[model samples]
Target: MTTNRTVQTAADAALWLAVHRGWHVLPLNYGTKRPLGGCVGCRADNKPDHTPQTCPCLARGDGALCHAVWAATTDPEVIRRWAQRWHTSVWAVHLGVSGLLAVDLDTRPDPPPHQPLNGLPWPADEPPPADGLDTYATLAALSGGTVGTDTFTTDTPSGGLHLLYEAEALRWKGSHGKPRPGDDTVRTGLGWQIDIKAYGGYVVLPGSTSKAGLYRRSSTTTTPRPLDPWLADALTRTGHDRTAAPDARPAAPVPVLDAQTGPARYAASALRSACAELAEMEPDTGRNRKLFRSTTRLAGMALAGWIDRTTVETALAEAARHAGLPAAEIRYVLASGFGRPLAVPDIRSAA
Candidate 1:
């Protein structure tokens, strides 16, 4: 009887639902958050330091997962084909890449006696996941409506829940566009483990399998509520630790767009525009590829002498901060997008 619930069927259903909503969808690796790596032949083809962007596999006929995120599309038939080929593949939906939001409410952090807390990597000092109930209650009251109660929700594999909402744009200021690995600290309304998967973010979609179990959707509230003004403001408020540290690391900086002349300044303006566009993109599947294309365009502009190297770096830094994806991943994404190696400091300034 259980074979009826094959991973392929669940993933296909998810793709179909996402496409119906105009949301781009992509396949993820089973029991893991990352996408499945390309087939063995593609891996062997990669040079010692070759990254995803430069991988010729993506351009080849068999490059199925070579460029995972870029393959996200709204075409129903294409989605069906992918579902058919990648049977065990789980599905993920990129949030904020398209400006959509997923408020993750985990099962209360109350771990069972002698049993670990459900698998979420929340900080040690945070409140139990059950408190999310209270947090949502608070938000719903602040919004002055019952919309929260009826909003779209999903059951995560770990026995937690995902509340789906639409945002005007990616809201939280966390991640400095450089979210780090093992870092699920992306902000949302106040509460422990209250996660905001938006703006260059993603979450495993419903109807997928994981080590925890199946990611199943519950009875959903169809209408998406707009970001309430109060709730929006609350989400932007981060605690002290979550704030940017004063440091020598690459920080989000205002690009050198003040000047009205010079090739570098013109490049800065163009790059800034690209950054802004990237920032406003709703989080959706294919976001990694979307990031690649957007960042690649910026890199190309710099190489083409349209913007200064420093300005390009600054633009990327700021955009990465806005994206809130892990900084390490950004490194790979940039490399993959460039089709070649890129060292921030090595980029030469234009004359």
Candidate 2:
């Protein structure tokens, strides 16, 4: 019996080590969950064998390392010792990361998920950050010569530029951008923003509509034209030519919502689902590109639902309030996309 007890002790220690290494150790405290917190640099919460020297913080490491040491040690004295040491502003990093989660929980609000792109184009690589207008302009200029112009046309309160071009012209501009979406910002490099619809096609600047400008798509392959021929000829030519027909409406989302209520329900559902899916699609470290298309799909769904003036206006007000976005030119996103009615959520609701 004594020998068996010794062997059992050894096995328990081995299992604990395995658990620290992320080997899926079974629960020891019955209902108690595994430790979820850890050192950010070395992932100490998930890794147990890490020593103080191996601690990513020790080589100039800080509170993250301290929390990690306390986290890894089972001894109460050691835990207390490390907890007392290595405390500082760096602790704020851990708190900041965890605080975001805590605030989301306490506020019972879903903050806009972290958008990992430099904002600078007709179609933003990421959702614009709060107070993002100035940064957005700088980022937009990076693509200045690529395929489109960044100018705002809306007369709203906040001023920002929109990318303008004929429906046929945007295709060339999106493909030629530098440090572009998915490549420079998100680092997944899977795809770039492609405009599939034609209409007002205005990108809104965040702060003041009065300052909003417009941009037309251009290409290095061909010399850039000042404006669409229809607009240019109307300004220059004497005779009216009916050769270019008005832009046609692109295909709409299937089972489009007609009523305002239907679209509202759809947009809310899509936004929540998209955020949940984004969390799942990217690794915790946030190294993934699939999120772009996934986010675009959400935006597309929202834009489709926006077709109803009442639904979009209401939802936009809510999303803006929740996101802390300024009211200036918020609806320009809808104008830029193919206006379609969202059908999926509405149909599902009926069922």
Candidate 3:
């Protein structure tokens, strides 16, 4: 029979939109269960002499407080307007994801000190998909061709690499500057770029470890260097072996939890740390470095190695805390407006 439980499912979906997709609505905490109810666990003395405590989910569970208007009208432009109206402030916006791959073994013996793992050739005019959900899947399908299938290892106790396909691609150029693709080359505003140093050890057999390096097409002016022989061999064994092409899929509208508890929370946290990294800034360029992108790449590395979001989030939070900043501040900026030059709190001061 149709019951209250059925209705709650739709309510839960609405809540997700509010948190992830910038829906302009409020969620009141009412329940004591995994999903929120009308101020869950809160009690009040609405007696002869006292007033009842206001419910967190006043209209949520009790009636129809959770509305659909939030998701229906939520958009970047609208969110910007809401921020201005509500005086909402954010720290930074983060974009893109990076992953690990099997390097051609022949080149691993003496890989370049810093080179892209592989060349990703995506069109410059590729528009971002509608929502976070679609963006990841679309990019994954496109990147799967280039990154291919592989196992990645991380510092987690498992020591086993996570099987990866593709990761998300986000941009906050309005708040943060964009990564200029192929500065000296013809490609600009293109999709599929990499950080030269985000590489971890390359994948080999059960016990062997290999350093990382970038590869280039023979047609490109760059040198074809070897980083790991096994990776290189793997590349040769696979077709194309050097470059990846874009798989253009429209990003889907998948509502997820807030950055604090979402799948991409780790990436968001790492973007903040990367942007604030002292060493990442280029003395000459002043602010042309791709540190955030590199760090996001590292998150991809974790994802590639099958590091769970919880693990990545924990490690990145620890790193940011050690670096001295509120963990949530970074995420707010990326989800909202990136590179907007925010005044984040000093973590050291909290101590």
- lDDT (CA) for every model shown? 0.56, 0.29, 0.28
The candidate with the higher TM-score, 1 or 2, is 1
Model 2 lDDT tens row, 262-288: 556655565544334433332343312
Worst 10 residues of 2 by lDDT: 97-106
Q: Which candidate is the best by lDDT?
A: 1
- Candidate 1: RMSD to truth: 18.2
TM-scores for candidates 1 onward, in order = 0.49, 0.18, 0.16
Provide C-alpha RMSD values for all models, in order.
18.2, 26.6, 26.4
Task: State how far residue 173 of model 2 sits from its true place (Å).
Answer: 47
- The lDDT-based order of candidates, best leading, equals 1, 2, 3
**lDDT of each residue in 1-351, candidate 1, tens digit only:** 224366666667666666666675777766566766556765566567566446665554342565556445556666677677766647777665445677776555542221111111333554433444544554445446443446667787666677777774444432221122433333323544456666556777777776677777775554456665555655543321223354433233345566565555555665667676555555564546666776666676667666555565545644765655555676677777667423333233533
Native RMSD of candidate 2 (Å):
26.6
